[model samples]
Target: MTETQTTAEAVTTTRPTLLEARDLHVEFSSRGRRARAVDGVNLAIGEGEIVALVGESGCGKTTLARTLLGLERPTSGEVRYDGNPLTYTSKALKTYRRQVQLVLQDPTGSLNPRHTVYEAVAEGPRIHGLPDEQDLVSKALSHAGLRPPDRFFLRYPHELSGGQRQRVVIAGALALNPKVLIADEPVASLDASVRGEILALLLRLRDELGLSALVVTHDLGLAWNIADRVAVMYLGRIVESGPVEQVLTAPRHPYTQALMSVLPESPERVVLTGEPPDPTRIPGGCRFHARCQVLASGKAAEAGVHTRCRTEPLPILPATPEAQAACYYAETTTP
Candidate 1:
């Protein structure tokens, strides 16, 4: 492990939490039934920390990100900023929005084709009635790595490359001088060659501006490369969370292990047999039991973990002071 490797607990104790979600749950009416998109999630991002929220598609990572940004209201629970619960009233939300900006997955769809980079980046400041708009926009563009900002100011979205377009979107968010950024798959739509550049820009912004970020992505490799911590979500719940190295290099939860196993560079692959369970009708005990390899391996019974894996709801608790996993057999298994 490198010197940069720090435990989640250490980070928590040393730095202040900039944004947090406590016992958050989001549900929607689907086919006359309630579908839970986020269920009982507690997450915190400390100042200047880049925490990666990763899981497969539809695992509720994006939904959680939206809730944190106040874009989507939670069915239950509350979001806090600087240890105070958020107020979602129109004015309160507006002020909160200024402090926490969102970066969408698809920059092309998010940015208007007719709008020039200047207009896109200035929109937030204009809405908030902030003064010095032009100066702020120029600084934002520069901060996002679009040097000689005036050259790109009049360029339309369609006129720029994919990476440049994404930078413009980031510049728009930075224009607000937000303390936190909720980035939903920030590089998912860009070319592979440009992904590293975008990721580097995020790190630079965090280091230079003391910005904290909740990066919602499905790429484990991205987590390893840039994130200080990684939170693994499954069926609307966080199954495992800890420092990136601890969680990725030695995953405890069966679900997290399965995800890591599928990474192309992984030497051992653990292929799951079934699709993810339906969110509308989540399992009774462990939501992952239906697809968990550790539980079905017939070894858990010997390890004395069979009963809880089948009948008890496993809460996300500390497997160690710095790491957590919501699996009854996590400590017993070697995954």
Candidate 2:
């Protein structure tokens, strides 16, 4: 199918459940130590929603993306595309690969130094054996806001600025006419000014192309600005997730609140104590208890909180119809 036709078809069709991950567990084994990077992460992305996975470094956001893309195999749990289990050798995997593309944070590093911009964008369609490579590359470049697309076609990666390189990376992904786009810290490397521009580009692409996206970032401000929904990850688990406004305005999980409080204010700053616990040796009960001010505030301790926070695992329960948090106190506590 032509790129235009494929895009149009995706738009006209009722929004499909593009991706679903349930109880995903990814582990790394080394020298008698097993580290679970993603611990039972359950998430879904509809056809056109932009879901942001926000967390500190080493919280497994990148690992989750790799698992979803079939780059890394999960030790347990399932990743599905369009309701079927995703396997490396399955036909669905190839189809999913063609329909889902990723934009990495470091565009310069991600793009091959040897390949020109045109070659980079055309690579996806060429590898997938899609007909009409010329048209697809042209459309991709245009869609990515690289005006006079032909001007950039022959330029090497080193020739472009950081923002331009990122634009090229985005164009390469768009070339596939992907149904789902997973951007792993797409703006982390850019200048402050360019970050907004790239974010605006992503937003425009979502609106104009009707693309669903899973954006992984450590920046809550970025998530608040661009994501439709946000999932907060802590210690390899999703501690809280909900609509962007609800989660940001009134976070339920203590970890989420701590993260929100750390956002820079003009004159006031909220100090967070302690460091995130080691994933390899995760603390019992609530993984965040040591750093949670609320939990340390005598009230939680006096409420006869006997189980866990030091022993048992807590269930992720619904805080409201639209939101859920992996904390026993989420439903009862008002944030």
Candidate 3:
């Protein structure tokens, strides 16, 4: 296979971290109550690594992504690029934004209906006041697989297919020569056939450009398809994280295990009794204990498991050198 060929086993490695979030917390207030979207979250993305942040809808993944990009200020904690805290000054922020690009979930909404593909892709360079705008736009379009770049230059968004539109959006991001890309549900809006193509294009971009990415989605299959590592978020926190294979195959946290159990190919099916607990009123002690089967079935209480499960929240601790989970019984429970 060629070096850029993507297969079942995707390439991934941990070099120095390029972007990181330390104890990040983002909260919003509504009617006198504060909602903790991202609560004390810590994450790191090594150069060239694809880390998939997976969870159900409203699990704070998108909020965390925005914080990492410096789009939203955290209630507390900090975001760092190349080990340095992000700067908030206008010039600094402009430079930082160029290095960290965001690919929105909806390509149609992201691209203006009135703008041609060339105009859309050229906007970044124009904003940055860069010369050689045409070269940058053409190269970005080509890199994003909009081959014969000239062919699509004059086409408007409505004239393109979903996959083509997404590629155009990606091309626009590439126009800035970004070091990292934060894609939110990149394939959720594409057809099944087109989804594979877009994913392949992303993998190719990583292999060819040495770009790092944080893919936020609920699809475990997508993680398996391209990501080297996976982080499972729940109720504003990372409940489990590790190499994709280890986390998907032998998940430690009950929440992680339950998620994996429901896959069409999973050997066991874990069906929790109720919907996820309200984020504004997240349960005390173990956040998941309210619906955790081990505790609910009386097994944990009978075995006299860690009493902390009934009195204090558990912090995510390492299960292996490369993995971590945030459950009191993560190491002992079968899930």
Candidate 4:
């Protein structure tokens, strides 16, 4: 891959953090067993920065996103916004949610078929009792790239194309003038052809509005395409995190390497064997040891790190301005 400067590095690490998850943990009980949905996660999103939380389904990315949006309460730890810790009171949450909006995965399900574009976009401000409803709605549509904003005002979601409906969903969020956008699987529901447009639209909004976003997804390729930095999640923890170019170009963690190798662009393939991740029974040492290609293939033993991989649990590290990995054998991998 050609080297390219990341958005954060292009400027400096001095960018103010807009949203943060500090030592965050979330747990759920079912069948008398506890499932660790989020485990000691610490992530920071800088102002105007785009961070992709990449992981397979059930890796806790969605739950983490929900925590960041104040939808789900954390069992331990804290989520802070703009340097202030989040409070759970109804009034406080209401005020907090106003500045931080959530954009869901499927736009079709997100938009009510009954409401026209204007009504959908105006819903937030109306609920917040904001003035100038008409102006807010129109401006939101324009920002979302629906030209001749009035053209979409009276149109129903079903009347527009899939991409247009998603834009309407975005317009709804834009109407609130949110500083941070938490998009859960933003392009997962769109056709491949239209994904680029939506991704490009997000980039434009970040540049034009200084919008900081946390994009949750299972696709590494999408992260490489749109994010300034990437955080790889496994089981319920971040295994590796850094700039998009650094992580995607030369991933150090075996789990991350396995993911990268499966990309269509990768010349060699590394298939992992054994049971899929089970949060309830996450392994003793490395949560990923059971499925780690390096350990399974005896590379860890060759490098004299096999004992550590099987018996030593790695710490839940932070994901941030500096690149780091939680794996002890990360340096053993060829970069």
Candidate 5:
């Protein structure tokens, strides 16, 4: 077998589950209409596994991440940690957050301009009432690549470069010494050169600390670089998921294929047509049927699954460890 295949197979695991979502759902009510930001979905992050959640904006990836982080309460269903269902009590949630920290999209906005580097990194430990704030802060900063940690003790958000600001945000989460990091677009704001640095830090942390992560991003390139497994979201559900290399290189779902086709410098590009329907008025059957290239090109009909694709929902089926897709046509034909 080739080196790439060997590497891909290495990540296909049945490790003990660390975090899980069982039929998770989250909804928002507005102007007499309800938006299902996160519809019925199930996902798991194995201990020491790095799973990337990929999707376009407004596709509920963020809502899913927030719900998993205990920041958003689901309308129904449950989020579980180590076999226990999530509880909404303030004390319980607070303790949960200490183990699963979030690194937001924007570093500048996430950090207060008034706070110094030391103060920013120290905040998490303080909030959790953890002891040895100074030591935790110093170690977190160093771990995040801000070495000679004392040198940055007095620097403000504006004083550091964009990459440094992001590192500070990461350090804050690290001070809590989280086992799981839910990083939403961690390197989105950094320049190309700096993006690599931040990504490297995340990988190192995962290897050295045995930290698992849920990296939420739209970039397939980033997922290929960092994730072991990947879940592709559409509208309010995970339509496809599996090992990253398998999904990225041989995506079976039509939506996932469209996404991969457009990766920078990819040989072919699939430009999708039309805006995603309003979340409040999500379409029936397949949420992606309306935008599906398979349906548009008559392939689903050719395969004898088109009508079913438009009138019935398909569950995400992992026929094998390498792949899964919530598409009747893809599943039937993906031998």
Candidate 6:
């Protein structure tokens, strides 16, 4: 992979922190079986910054997003917004809900067919008792790139195309005038031709509104295109995270390197490999041991697979000037 610059150096800031999660864990019990969807994840999103959470499906990206939104309760750990503990019933939570919104993966599933675009977008303002509902809806539609705005006002979810429906969802989120947005696979269902356009809209929203975002996706190229920071997750854990360029170009974790290897160079390239392991029966320690090529290249036996990756979970250690990886063998440039 070609080396690239770090996002930290690309953007100038005073290290302003907007949201933080400390050792967050989310667990569930189904029919006497215990499963931990998120395990001891730590993350921070800075003001006006876009952070991308990239991982395979079932890696807990969506679960983590739900937890952050206060839609799902964590089994342990803490979530803080602007340094205050998040509470679902607190007065601050009402304010926080208004300041934070989500754009779900399936626009059709989330949107109501009974409501028109105008009603859908205006719902937030109406529920929150914000003044000037009509004006806010108009502004949201315009901001979402549905120019003229009148054309989309009477359209239903089925009346609009996939991309158009997604834009409506974004407009609805924007109507709340949120300071932070959590987009879970916002462009996953759109056609290739429309994906870039949607991504551009998101970038525009960030720039024009000064909004911070946590975009959850499995596409590295998409993350490269829009994210300021990239967090690579594996088996419910953040295996590698830091500035987008640093994590992509100079990956520290073996799992991260493996993920990047599959990205096509242009539009026609392919990198084939086995699928990731089952989350329910995740391997001990690293949880990525089953698919780690470096670990399976005849060196694992000598290194003792159980000893290196099954006994003790590795901590996320600093691997570069501005990055961290949770692999014992992660490379570092300095030292």
The residue-by-residue lDDT of candidate 4 on 1-335, one tens digit each, is 11111122121244788888877889999679999899878788999999999987889999999999999999988888987889999999989988999999899999999999999999999999999999999999999999899999899999998899899999999999999999999999999999999999999999999998999999999999999999999988888998999989988888888889889989889887865577888788888888888888887899998998888877666545667787868856545
Please, what are the lDDT tens digits per residue for candidate 2 over residues 79-142? Answer: 8787677877767567888878889999989999999999999999998899999899999999
lDDT of 2: 0.82
Clashing pairs in 2: 285-309, 285-310, 285-311, 286-309
Clashes of each: 0, 4, 0, 0, 0, 0
For model 1, residues 224-334, the per-residue Cα lDDT tens digits are 988988899998988899899988998888888988987887898988888888889988888898888887887678789888778877764321226778777876654
TM-scores for every predicted model: 0.93, 0.90, 0.92, 0.94, 0.94, 0.87
Clashing residue pairs in candidate 1 are none
Ranking by TM-score: 4, 5, 1, 3, 2, 6
Better of 2 and 5 by TM-score: 5
TM-score of predicted structure 2: 0.90
RMSD of 6: 5.6
lDDT of each: 0.86, 0.82, 0.85, 0.87, 0.87, 0.79
As a TM-score, model 1 comes out at 0.93
Q: What is the lDDT of residue 45 in candidate 5?
A: 88
lDDT of model number 5:
0.87
Candidate 2 stretches with Cα past 4 Å from truth are 1-16, 90-92, 266-270, 306-308, 317-321
Q: What local lDDT does model 2 show for residue 150? A: 93
**Per-candidate RMSD vs. true structure?**
4.9, 7.1, 7.0, 5.2, 5.6, 5.6
Better of 5 and 6 by TM-score: 5
Clash pairs detected, candidate 5: none
TM-score of 6: 0.87
In angstroms, the error of model 1 at 302 is: 2.2
Candidate 4, residue 23: Cα displacement in angstroms equals 0.5
